[model samples]
Target chain A: MNGVRKAQTSPARSRFRDEDLPGYLFMAPWILGFLLFTLGPTLASLGLAFTKFDLLSPPQWIGVDNFTFMFTQDQRFWNALRVTFVYLLLEVPLKLAFALAIAMAMDKGIRGGDLYRALFYVPSLLGGSVAIAVLWRQLFQGDGVVNQVLLWLFGVQGPSWISNPETSLYTLVILAVWQFGSPMIIFLAGLRQIPAELYEAASIDGATRWKQFWRITLPLLAPVLFFNIVFQTIEAFKAFTPAFIISGGTGGPVDSTLFYTLYLYQEAFAHFRMGYASALAWVLLVIIGVCTTLSFLASKYWVFYEDER
Target chain B: MSAEAGPGQVGSEPTIVGVIARHVLLIAGSVLMLYPLLWMLASSFKPEAGIFSNLSLIPPSLNPKNYIDGWNALEVSFSRFYWNSFLIAILVVIGNVMSCSLTAYAFARLRFRGRNILFALMMMTLMLPYHVTLIPQYVLFLNIGWIDTILPLVVPKFLAVDAFFIFLMVQFFRGLPRELDEAAKIDGCGPWRIYWMIILPLSKPVLATAAIFSFLWTWNDFFGPLIYLNDISRYTVPLALRAFVDSTGTSAWGQLFAMSTLAIAPIFLFFLLFQRLIIRGVAMSGLKG
Candidate 1:
């Protein structure tokens, strides 16, 4: 078999010497696209971060002034950051835990699992759209279904979830948690990879189900959990559409739902502060990078792979 | 795939009470999850005053006026938005399939200097948020006079700018046996022939996944069209839906709900028809990552 493979590839190697051109040609679209769209814009945004460009006027170099303004002067910048962090804190853990629990429940081999999985996944499929965001606004309105249900069932008046300043951000968080299908699906896939014999061995060894989960499931599923955490955190940070639609694109109710991206978008488009927005965008990139790196470093302690073992 | 394992072991059947309890919990969760969507659908059929006043899923009367008003509520009809979304989604699906599969073929089956570095760069692009690239991309499109056109939204897709699809296709391509390519090469099949004839034909599942995801994402995309297309005439469904609600909250809520329901109907239908492929695609992405 090895000799046959060697014999096959030797002539192909000679032919492939000239075939690099086709290979490169095939890759040209992505290469050109990356250079023009991603790389070029990344560098341009970096340069623009230090300049004042509002699309009409030529970009004026202002050297670190944008950063200084963000650091020292902009209260809304701080508010956006605080709101985003609160959102991240509330969203990432709750969504992941909820997804993991549901995935574990599903892992017990429920009848018609596919139907349940598909139904559960519907929200995520519609989660990012403007239509769903509008629906969320209606659902949380003062006289909407949520409040109506509260009044009917508990005889308590429900606050306008999206309109109330104190509760508006939580409404977005709840929305984030409600669309837990993606991570739940991921966790389910991960659960399938855990060998069944491990559970059998644990059970034979007199391990309780709860103990088996702690000993077998969580440890083996750590890498998947870590992945989900990192992904969901980044996603939570970048959430825009829900907040945009809910707050009428203003990040309002006194900036209660002013997500970092929404604020950046308002600065860039609504106010035409492209330079300031560029600065905000760079800061967001750094924050995400730092969070990702920290997670990677943290994963060293807990995230185990079968190959690594 | 292993045979289905019970919560404990193979021989032990779960208690009927336990099974019933699981179903009960699942049913409750499903209702909670599905309530918003059902409420929206119900509200679409309700009268304007009945929308906020009555919380019943059963409208007092099955009024279809909301649908009629919503269809023509804005300056442009909902058909224009739906047509625009479909046109963009179809083009995006084509672009992603054509460009990403080619790129994935090159990365998977071919070798060149800087191949690893380029692949790494492509993977790195996955982590870079679109917001970081939004301003400069907007500026570039503006400079090229592609603003207010679908070109900005549709063109980058042809270039395989979305690295997620490229990565997905690469994973699929790499899983194919190398012997097939070798056999094709011995048969005097060129790279193009091997890719188009051999690889593409063999990759229906991944291709279907890619096409479905690209269509769904493009159909639901709000930001790209929001930033690029300025005219209401050129607006996609998401933008058109946003136009239903004015800032003052005095806008037509019933019409908005009606149009919103109609907007998501295609996605809901698509999800139902292609649920298996979609779930598998999502699972493949998550597990591979």
Candidate 2:
């Protein structure tokens, strides 16, 4: 398919030399933006990592010092990293499982499925949002509605979920899990793509519903599952707004909710440690890159893309 | 892998029981999901003490002053914040539609030296968390004196800097039939003309998709406003909402809830307006496109 299209375009390429120019012209704004916004800052940050470049002052070059501080001296960086990893580990698998289960159930042609899907998706739209996070702060506060409900139901006392270190992070984790909408929508789309004939054939062989799911549905949905997993995992790591907003940008309660990105934000902006923050950013980039590469490698064993080489 | 009860055996168990169980789960789940919003609405009408005292979904008395106080006490003009968010969202939609679709068309159709490499780079940008570049970008904006303005927030989107949107457009562009481009070319058209005359017209579904996403992301982008805009008067809705979160005075649960509800209402309305298209776009973008 690629060869045919290339040949067709190649022969008449000269007739459409103007075509390429227009495409580039249309793309000029983006090219300019890529250079200024993304590339410029990205490179500057790398350079700044080896130096102290507070906003108010000129950068002072101190090679490898910031790196040494982060790795060997900064316990907070490691703490943030550990907090982020735990958040990622718990959030990703639970979200994927819940999303998939909900999608599968909705795909069963139940009544009012669209409404159910919409309800399921609303939290996702609101999940990372400040307003929702603020609302979450209220709902989980010491005298907030959640604890009040617990009081009414079990007559058992509950800690302030968003104020206490032990439960504050869990509130954010639950919020992360609630935004299972996007993945659920994707899974529904994937489930619908499977040939109905496969399910029919399985049923003809007297296969149970559970067996059919394992043999047919699960295999067919693996590619979509892979996409959801990678995106969600990265997103979980990148989660900041909830922690930032709910904890009032302190990630407080003893910094229990101090996610890596939040800590990076604090370092860069709050402390004006531009050099250190840059190193932290690069480290995060490397971690994400390594994680994604590993996921891609692992996918070869499980994810079955259609029309693969 | 069949369980103790197979399909036929499962059918022997009362079908009514299974159906009832499904209904119970769905209803219970729905209630759990909607409870927070329900409580928020109820609490907004309640008196300040009632907010913490009563856990009822129904408040005893409605204190309409929450809405009034929230509107009156806002440091930045609430109407202005709305306008700012609206202006930013509209510009983002316009920028994304033009730039994203054009770049996507290039990646999907046109061949150029380093095309594959550039496309791969674009995908690589997707994996780089925004925090990595966020501070540096803020510093650059500060240097250029674009801080305290919406330019830093709105302008970068025009450059296809948002890899997710670019990738989304690329997938949609690839899905279009090559025959459309062929026919357009045969009609004395070049790539730009084809994009204008053929591709843009057929791209409504995806364009709407991009529009809805750009709108939502820009509207909810608190970090951008938080980092760049120091002037409270220049605040967007999200930043404006933060005013209710006080360290000195009492936390205005009533007013905060009221403003949050007001802030959330329009976006919810937008979602409802574009529900089908947005859902279709999401499904397509994630599933195959």
Candidate 3:
């Protein structure tokens, strides 16, 4: 297909020589943006990572000191890292599981599926906003709805979910899980792509529905699942707004909800430790890079692309 | 791996038990998902003292006092925040649709030298977390005195910094039958004319998707406005909403909820009206990426 197009376009190639100016002209905005916003700042941050710069004064060359301090001296750095990983571990699987189950249910051809999907997706639409975060704070307060429900149902007083250090991170995790609509939508689309005949064939062979799911659906859905996992994992890692707002921008109550990005923000803006924050940013970049690379590597074993088959 | 009993197959007239069970589960989950929002809406209409005293979504009385009080609760009236948010979101939508489609058209239809490398770099930007670029971008903007203005938030959109939309439109433009472009070319429609006339008209769905998402994300964005604009008068909805709650002192919970409902109302309405486009966008972007 591509070969034929290339051959056809070969005659147009001569025209493209003249068209090159317009092509680059069309691309001017993105090219300019890439150079200014993405490439330039990325390179600048790399340089800033090696210097001791506060915004008030000029940067002094500090060879590897910021990284050394982050690794050796900053317990909060480790705490932020641990908090982020824990959030990722807890949030991604639970959110995906919730999304998948709801998607499967929706796939069964329920009535008003559109309405249900819309209702289910509303939280995600509003999930990252300051209003939702503020609402979450109120909902999880000691005397809030969550505790009120607990008290009414089980006759037991519940701890302040958002304020307590031990459970604070979980509140954010719950918030993350609540916004499973995006993954659910993707999963639903994936589910629809599975040929109905596959299930019909399995049923004819006396394969139970569960067996058909394991035999047909799971394998077919693996690629979509993998996409959601990697996407959601990266999102979970960079999660800041909920934690930032829930903890009042302090990441406080002994830093329980101190997300990595929030901590980076605090270090850069609050403390004006631009160099250290730059190091933190680079570390985050490396971590995300490593995680994405590992997922792609691991996908070879599990992810089953339809075209590959 | 078959469950004890699977839900009935699609297109085979589902059983009553299956339908009932499905609605039961869906409604249960939907309530859980929507309860917080409902509570907020209910709390917004409740009296100040009644907000925390009860868990009921029903307000004792439908009072407009919270809405009235919250309108001017901040230093600037809530209308200013709404105007700032709407203005920024509209600009962002216009900028993203205009620029991303142009970029996507170039990559999809008009190949130039170094196109492959440039395309790969654009994709890489999708994975690069904003944090890596935040400080330097902030410094760059700061040096240029663009900080505290809407320029930092609005200018990047016009520059097509959002690669997701570019990738989305690329996928869309590639799906367009090449015959149309060829037909246009034979008629002496140059690349620019073909793009503006043929591609843009045929690409309404993706363009609408991009516009909706750009609008939604920009309106809900907190961190950008938070970092760039420090002045209360310049605050967007998200930032202004945050100002309602004074952690140290008394926060007017009813008024906060009132304002929050106002802040989220437009987005909710947008989602309802264009849910199909938004969901399609998510599915397309996720699967393709």
TM-score of 3: 0.96
Report the candidate with higher DockQ, 1 versus 2.
1
CA-based DockQ, model 1? 0.58
The recovered share of true contacts, given per candidate in order, is 0.66, 0.47, 0.71
Q: Output the better candidate (2/3) by lDDT.
A: 3
Tell me the lDDT of candidate 1.
0.88
- In order of appearance, the predictions have TM-scores of 0.96, 0.93, 0.96
The residue pairs found clashing in candidate 3 are: A210-B2, A211-B2
Cα displacement (angstroms), candidate 3, residue B114, comes to 0.9
- Winning candidate number (lDDT): 3
Provide the lowest-lDDT 10-residue window in model 2 chain B.
B1-10
Error of 2 at A127 (Å): 2.8
Docking tier of model 3: it is: medium
Ranking by TM-score: 3, 1, 2
Q: Write the per-residue lDDT of candidate 1 for residues B1-289, one digit (tens) a residue.
A: 1222334333356666666666777788888899788888888898788787676677777789999988998889988999999999999999999999999999998876678899999999999999888999999999999999999989999999989989998999999999999899778787899999999999999999999999998989998899999999999999988888763264578888888999999999999889989999888878859
| Per-residue lDDT over A1-309 for candidate 3, one digit per residue giving the tens place of the 0 to 100 score | 343356467755665465578889999999999999999999999999999988889888999999999999999999999999999999999999999889888775567988888888888897589988988899898888888889899999999888789999999999999999999999988888888777777777788766777888889899999999999998888888888888889997899999999999999999999888999999999999999999999999998787887
Write candidate 2's Cα lDDT for A37-105 as tens digits: 777778888888889888788889999999898899898999899889988998999999988887866
| Winner of 1 and 3 under DockQ | 3
